[model samples]
Target: MEHVYIGLGSNLADPAEQLRNAVQALGQLPDSVLVGVSAFYQSDSLLPGQPRYTNAVVALDSDLAPLALLDALQAIEIDQGRERHERWGPRTLDLDILLFGDRLIDEPRLKVPHYHMQARPFVLYPLAELAPVDLQLADGRTLKALLADCPFVGLERLPH
Candidate 1:
């Protein structure tokens, strides 16, 4: 099984509970086992006019391929009432494939390492908690180094 990192966020309908339920759903993916989940964070919405979000990162060991994993994630989002009407819109639940076992993919439907991970602390801080110290980007930069340059502020770790 390959290691995979997934970013989860919710801004509607009890955001924290939405994320908690999503994490539980992730553990039920076919051929996958959830390894860990970072602490929930309350962060400002990245896009204007949206409510605050509860964010987290989850680690998993999965035998599914990247595209398959993407499909599964989308399915989970749909199950959680996610809508795609607007880019960066408020979501009931959002699931993004952040890193797929060091694979770099640029397809019409998916991108590995999440094209914008480095710029968002909501993703990076939680991801750093679950990723290895030696984890490197496709360009060979370490996750820790990329996090150093992230300017996103106002992330607060939620109490357990």
Candidate 2:
């Protein structure tokens, strides 16, 4: 199985429950196993005027290919009442493939190591909790280093 990291975020419909439910749903993916999950973090929205978000990272061991895994994640979002009314808009559930087994992918519908994960504390902080300390980014920085420079500092770890 390939090691995969997924980022989860929700700002609508009981955001905390949405994250917990998403983690459970991820465990049910065919040929996949949920490995680890970080404590949920609350952060201000990336876009002004939007609600704060509940965010976390999940580690998985999966046999599914990257695209298939992406499809599964999108399916979970849709199943949980997600709507694409706006770009980076508030959502009921958002699941992003942050990293897929050290593989880099650039596709029309998906990007691995998620394009903006490195720069966003909402993603990086929770990810740091789950990812290996030595995990390297595309820019050749370690996850620890990336966390040091993450500009978004509003993240507050939520209770278990």
Candidate 3:
């Protein structure tokens, strides 16, 4: 099994509930075991005029191949009413493959060590909670270094 981290976000239709439902679905993925989940956080949307997003990170150990895992995640998003109407637009659920083991992947449909993760506090902070202090990305960047660069700003930790 490979260690994987997934980033979850939602801004429409009761965001927190959406994340909760997504988490449950993640736990049921075939050939995967949901290991850890960080606390939920509320953060401003990437684009202005959109509702705040509820976000969290989950750790999974899966035997499934990377593309297969991505497919399963997309299926879960669709099942939860996700619509790709616009780039960075609001959605009921958004699941991203933040990291897939220590592999650096670049496929037409997927990119591991997710492109913009190092700079997003909503991604970094929650990831810090579940990742090791010495965690290193496939790209040679350390999780601790990334956290140092990305401060926890414009984010609110919701009660569990």
Candidate 4:
């Protein structure tokens, strides 16, 4: 099995609950086992006119290849009534593949070790928690430190 990290977010229909359900749902996909999930965070919407988003990151051990994992994540979003009408649009659930075993894949349909990952507090905060073993950077700084250094606010850790 390969180590995979996924970023999750939701802004509609009980945002925190939506994130929780997505995490539970992801665990059931074939060839996958959820290893860790970070605390839920409420953040300002990245998209214009959208509601606040509850964000998280989940760690997993999975046999699926990168493309396959992307497909599975999309299926979960679809299951949650997500519709992609615009970039960064409102979502019932959003899943992003943040890392896939250090494989560094880039393709038309998928990118492992998600680009713009470290730039987003929502992604870094949760990923740092879920992948406690690996931490968030090759550099010495921590996710929490990066978060503090950045301008984003209102990050809080929570239990499942």
Model 3 C-alpha lDDT per residue in residues 23-94, reported as the tens digit of each score: 999999999999999999999998989999999999999999999999999999999999998877899999
TM-score of each: 0.96, 0.95, 0.99, 0.86
Candidate 4, poorest ten consecutive residues by summed lDDT: 133-142
> In model 3, what lDDT does residue 100 have?
95
Winning candidate number (lDDT): 3
Cα RMSD (Å) between model 1 and the true structure? 1.1
Model 2 regions more than 4 Å off: none
Window of ten residues with lowest summed lDDT in model 1 = 132-141
Error of 3 at 5 (Å): 0.2
Residue 23 shift from truth in candidate 4, angstroms = 1.1
Q: Between prediction 3 and prediction 4, which has the larger lDDT?
A: 3
